[model samples]
Target: MTQHSDVVVIGGGQSGLAAGYHLRRLGIEHVILDAQAAPGGAWQHTWDSLQLFSPAAYSSLPGRFMPAQEGEVYPDAAHVVSYLADYEKRYELPVQRGAWVSAVHRDGPYLRVETSSGDWRARAVVSATGTWTRPFLPAVPGRRDFTGRQLHTVQYRSPAEFTGQRVIVVGGGNSGAQIAADLTGTAELTWVTQRLPRYLADDIDGRALFDAATARRRALDVGRTDTGGVASLGDIVAVPPVRAARDAGLLCAKPMFTRLTATGVEWADGARAEADVVIWCTGFRPALAPFAALRLRGARGHIATDGTRAVDEPRLHLLGYGDWTGPASATLIGIGRPARDAARQIRDLLG
Candidate 1:
């Protein structure tokens, strides 16, 4: 026997919570299934001392504001998790934690969602599983042969654990740069990155970027019907991380490695860099394995969805997808519009 709902949200993060809240406001009954034991998916696993580059005002969900201490730069990961938990409790959202969705398939007219616990049937499904569930690490040649400890930024909690060690941090994104800076005084650090360097402006924060990105996303969403192939680099630029890294002289504006030896990494230019610990600051990708049937576009394994609708499957939708050259399409602010639009579409379909 399987439980049923008008809709089933396949994540318990902020996007999913917003979906549930909207659906409830519309009087549409729905259940949210999450893999984690609680809300706040990646935030719970992030490194300590991590704060949102964006401010509390822009980071808040639909109805509630993210509480913050006066003069705080941004809310930390723990604050984010606490805010999410409070949001869940306040709404009493129908979320079943620890129910890791293994597969989702279209069974007749409804979608069948199989989890570790059991199966569920829903008329509509919203994949709010943001693009950070899986860490994207390159397959370095001699990665397996390295005897010392190596871990992704996801597993890194703090620099306290790596005191006095030679650490090589790879990737040029915010995480990579910030982590490199964090380990600077505590440990010897080297920063590495691939080609096509993306730099942030000297003057933006989460609030400003969020507002700018939101406007751009809205314009694009309205102007274009088929946004499948269009790629937008949202407002990923903010001053905090970039400034911090620049001040610390930790930015590695170079291409990636060609090979990895047992002792060190070989760059494309034939230069070799060695370190005791290799921290792949490579970013994350969406965990879309459960929706295997829905073929995604791009070799990078990202789903191709129109602003709100999945390109391959009309009935399915993707929220928090990174849009090309716009405001923060993949951030928390970027997800709300898509989620709301998708939920509305689902409600109409159910009717």
Candidate 2:
């Protein structure tokens, strides 16, 4: 039997849960479908040592706030997972875990969402699958010829596993910096990037970044084109650990290498460096494979959207697709406004 819902949220991560929080307030009938076996979404898969760039007071979902743990200024990934699970329980949002969404296609007047467990027809759909699953690695000549282990950040668990081995961490983003810092005690680490990494001042964190972005976005929303673009939140935030690393001179990085040789990477100058492992912190693309049947993604592999609303499919909304959906929508604190707006639109449509 095909189940039907007023709205079906196709992810149980930060964005989907935030949307569910709004839909509940609107008294909409909806269910969140999570592909993960548990409630944490992508947080469950992050590296064990991962910590939020912001303090707990600054990073939270809607309806309730993430409480700061004793002695922990910044919550680690496990803490976040625990909080997400607790939030779901506290709100009683109807979520179907282990429901891997396979595809979503137009079905007459509704969107038919096919999943591993079954199918659902929904009046409105919010796609928030996020980017963790689609890790990206830059192309390099002789990449395949390298016999050394190469993995994206998503596959990394702990630095202990690579203790004392030569490791190359690639990318200038926060993830690369943080992971490289984590490896300092365990690995013979080398940081490689296309360019020099940018570090936000020690006083700034994810909270300030999100706030600045919100202001800039709201200015643009009001038809003022003078909103100076906010700095990228990807810049390394000087959290305690990252700060210590920088002060200790362990956070240094090198420019990108030219290619991957059998033993390791070679620089543009033809200098070869030996490495046992390469951790590519290159980043991720949104995981919206379930919407492939709609063929809405453009040449850039991203869907055109009027804010969070799909431009080609009015009944479909794309959240957590990053800034294209909403300013800082990919972050915990930045997703709430867009979620509320999306839920309101769904309510108006259904009514």
Candidate 3:
């Protein structure tokens, strides 16, 4: 027998939890389903030492504030997971953990979510799976033949694991840079990326980024008729990890690899660099394959939602999508409005 709900939220991360909380506040009956056995989603799987670039004040969910000191750099992965668990319990959000959603289809008027455990039907669906579902590891030729161990940054937990190993950290993103810096003291480290990464200043924290993006979005909202997508202004030229690496004389900006060999990685310029380990911090793809019929607009498999609301399917909403304007869109702080808006929209539809 298929269980039923007025609305079913897929993915029990910050977005899903916020959605459930708002729905409950509006007297809507809903259930949140998450594939993970616990609540924090990808955060739980993050490296143990990982910390948010933003501060704790900007990391709170809708109802509850993050239990941390003001102006403190955001908590690590473990603290984030603990906070999510606390949020779930405090709000009494109806979350079914370890329920991996296999597929989502529109069955007549309701949305059918088929999971490993069972199936559920709902009047509406919110895809809060976030953008980091699948790690993107480039398949360079001879990668399989690499003599040293190769791992994606997703599986990487600490530099201690790669101690005394000559490690090549690919991709110049924040994660890659940080991992390289962390390994510098313990191992021989080299940083690589296709383009010189444009680093945003440390002052460009999550709140500031959200605020600037929000103002630009509101201008467009008022019929200003700006050409092209909202251009990200402000100083995004100082990647923290890159700056740290430069300060430590450990930064190396280079083009991506042409192939991987048993001995080492070969650059597109036909130069070969040897290493005992390769850490690919390429990036992540969205978890939208299950909802393939939605026809999203973003490159790299991200669902292109319009300011918290999904574009193609207005009834189907997405929260916590990366790169949204406002202090509350991508961060835990920004998720509240989107979740509340989605809840209101669902309540109206159900009524």
Candidate 4:
């Protein structure tokens, strides 16, 4: 049987939960569908030692603030998972877990959401299925020919398996820095980047990043000078472990290698390092496969949107992808604004 809802949120992560919270507040009936068997969304898949740049109090959804973890300043992945599960229960958000969304297509006046559990026809659909599932490994030359083990950031858990091995981590972002740091004293670690890694000031954390992003957005909105939000600051934040690693000179990064040999990688200047493992801390693209039937994405490989609402298809909204959707829509703290706007737009459209 085909079910119905006022809105169908196609993810139950921070963005989806935020949408549900706002919709409930506005008395709008909606349902959140999640592919994951439980809550936490992509956070559940993060490495074991990963910690947020911000404290628990600063990382929260719309209605409720995340409580401080008992002994930690920055909460770990498990703490975040527990918080999300509790939030879902506390708000009584209608979330159907393990309901993997296959596709969403236009159905006359409504949108038909095809999922493994069932089909739902909704007045509006919010596609918040974030970027974790689509881990991006760049097309480095000889990447396929390399005989050593290779893995992306999503597959990494801890450094226990990498002991006594020569490992090279690629990417200048926080993930690479953190993972490199995690391997300290364990693996013969080598960090590589396209350019020299830039670190934000020790005082700068996610709170500062959020504020800067908000300021930059507001400035751009009024046609003022573009204040480079987080971009101007640096690429990586010095979270505790990362900071310690950098201070100890363990985060020194080498220029990106030109190609991979059977056993290792060779740099541009003919310096080669033998490696047993290579970890690509690259990144992810949005999981927009469910929206493929709509043919909404542009040449940049993302859907054009005006404040979370799809420009061409007004009934669809893309949330939590990144700044393209909203200023800081991908972060737990930044998602509320966009999610609220999406809910409001849906209410207005359905009314």
Candidate 5:
């Protein structure tokens, strides 16, 4: 039997939960579909030492603020998991765990969501599935031929596992810097980047980044001069650990290698370094496979959207992916506005 809902939220992560909170407040009936068997979403799958770029007060869902982790200026992954779990229980949100959605297609006036457990027909569908599942690795030559173990951020747990082994960390972004910093003293570490790593000011964090993004968006909305945002500052934030690593001269990064070798990697200048492992902190793509039948993706490989609503199909709202969905929507603090707006639009549509 096909289940039914007024709205179907794919992904019960921070974005989806925020959407649910607003929808419930507006008296809109909806269900959140989570691929994970438990709460915390992607946070649960992150490295053991992963910490939010912001403090606890700065990272929170819609109705509830994340509690501060005692003795920690920046909370760890476990604290976040506990907070998300508690938030879910506090609101009693209608989330169906382990409901991995396989596909979503049009079925008359409703969007048919086919999942591992069952199917649901909803008047509107919200795609909040963030990008952790689709870790991207650049097409560097000889990658497959390399004998060293290669793993993306998703597979990494801790540096202890590779202690004393020659390891290379790739990419210039936060993940790359953080992970490379985490590997200090634990591995024979070599950090490589396509370009020199850019670090944000030590005082700036996700809070400042979110505020900048909001300012930029607001400025653009009023047709004023465009203001720069997080990108304007730099890529990586000088979080405590990252800053410490840099001060200690452990976070130095080399230019990207020309190709992977059977034994390790080689640079264009013929410099070679043997390695036992390579960690790709390259980032991710949107997990939009469920919407493949919609044919909404543009030539840029992203779905064109008019303020969260898909331009090709207004019935579908894409959230939490990135700025394309909403400014800073991928972050916990930034998701609320878009989630509230998406919920309101959904309510108006249902009416």
Candidate 6:
């Protein structure tokens, strides 16, 4: 039987749960479809050593704050997963796990949501599918010929398996830096970035970046086009682990390689760096596969939204797709505000 909901959220991660919290507060009837068999969303699949950039208080969803794990200041991935599960239970949010969404399309007065297990015809659809599933791998010269193990940050786990091997980490982002640190004692590691890596001061953490981004967005909201030298997410934060790595002279990043060789990599001047493993810490594109049939994407392959609502398709709201959808919706702290706005818009639409 085809299920029906007033609204459908197409992910059960932090974004979806935040949206669910707001929807529940409004007494809106909705359902969340998750591809994962259990709760936690993409965090469940992240590398085991991953830790939030800030304390537990900073990494929270709407309505409920993420509790710090016992004796731990900053929560890890497992702690986050546990919190998500508890959040669902606390609110009794209707979530259908293992229901991987295949596609979504127009269906007369409502939108039809197709999934692996069943279908849902919803009055509104909030796409909270984040970028974790679709890891972006940049094209390096002679990429196909490299015979060694090459993996993206998405597939990264503990660095213990890489012990005694030569590993090269790519990208200058926080993920790249953290992973580089984790592989420090285990692997003979080399960090590579397109440009010189920018490390923020030790006091500047994820919250600072969020604040800077928020300020920039606020400035953009008004007529002012100038963003008075705000920091970007691409810059690395000086977390304890990263700082330790730097102290040990391990955080140095080399320039991007000129090309890949069968055994390793070659620099522009013909210098070679032999590596047994290559971990690409490049970023990600939004997971918008289900919205393909909607034809709502802008020139950038993302759904153009006006404060979370799709510009072309009003019934479709995209959440947790970074600043393009809403200010800071992609981060745990940033997601709550936009989720409330998106929920309000969806509730008003349903009414």
Q: Give the TM-score of candidate 4.
A: 0.98
List lDDT for all candidates, in order. Answer: 0.75, 0.89, 0.76, 0.92, 0.92, 0.88
Alpha-carbon TM-score of each model against the true structure: 0.88, 0.97, 0.87, 0.98, 0.98, 0.97
RMSD of each: 3.4, 1.4, 3.1, 0.9, 0.9, 1.4
lDDT of model 4 at position 179: 95
Clashes of each: 9, 0, 10, 0, 0, 0
Model 1 clashes, total count: 9
Q: What is the C-alpha lDDT profile of model 5 across 1-351, one tens digit per residue?
A: 899999999999888889889998999899999999899999999988788999999999888989999989889999988988898889989999999999999999999999999999999999999999999989999999999799999999999899899999999999999899999999999999989999998999999999989888888889998888788989999889899999999988999999999999999999999999999999999999999998887865789988999998889998998888899999999999999999888888888
Candidate 1 vs 6: which has more TM-score: 6
Misplaced by over 4 Å in model 2 are 222-234
lDDT of 5: 0.92
TM-score of 2: 0.97
Q: Which scores greater on lDDT, model 1 or model 2?
A: 2
- TM-score: model 5 vs. ground truth: 0.98
**Model 3 lDDT, full chain set:** 0.76
Model 2 agreement with the true structure over 120-224: per-residue lDDT tens digits: 999999998999989998888888999999999999999999999999999888889889989997899999988887888888888888887887888888988
lDDT digits (tens) for residues 248-278 of candidate 4? 8888899999999999999878889999999
Give residue 18's error in model 3 in angstroms: 1.3
Q: How many backbone clashes does candidate 6 have?
A: 0
Candidate 1: where is the Cα deviation over 4 Å?
Answer: 195-199, 215-245, 248-255, 268-270, 294-299, 324-329
Candidate 6 displacement at residue 324 in angstroms: 0.8
Give stretches of model 3 more than 4 Å off: 69-72, 139-142, 220-245, 293-307, 324-328
Model 1 agreement with the true structure over 1-351: per-residue lDDT tens digits: 798987888889877888888888888989999989877877898888777877787787777887874667677888889889999999999999999898888888888889988999888888878767688878878788777778888889899988988888887667877787678778877777764545555555666556655665666668954432212332235446556766666655556777777877777678987778989988788778889964555566766666567676666766665663124546766566666777788888888
**Candidate 1, RMSD to the unseen true structure:** 3.4
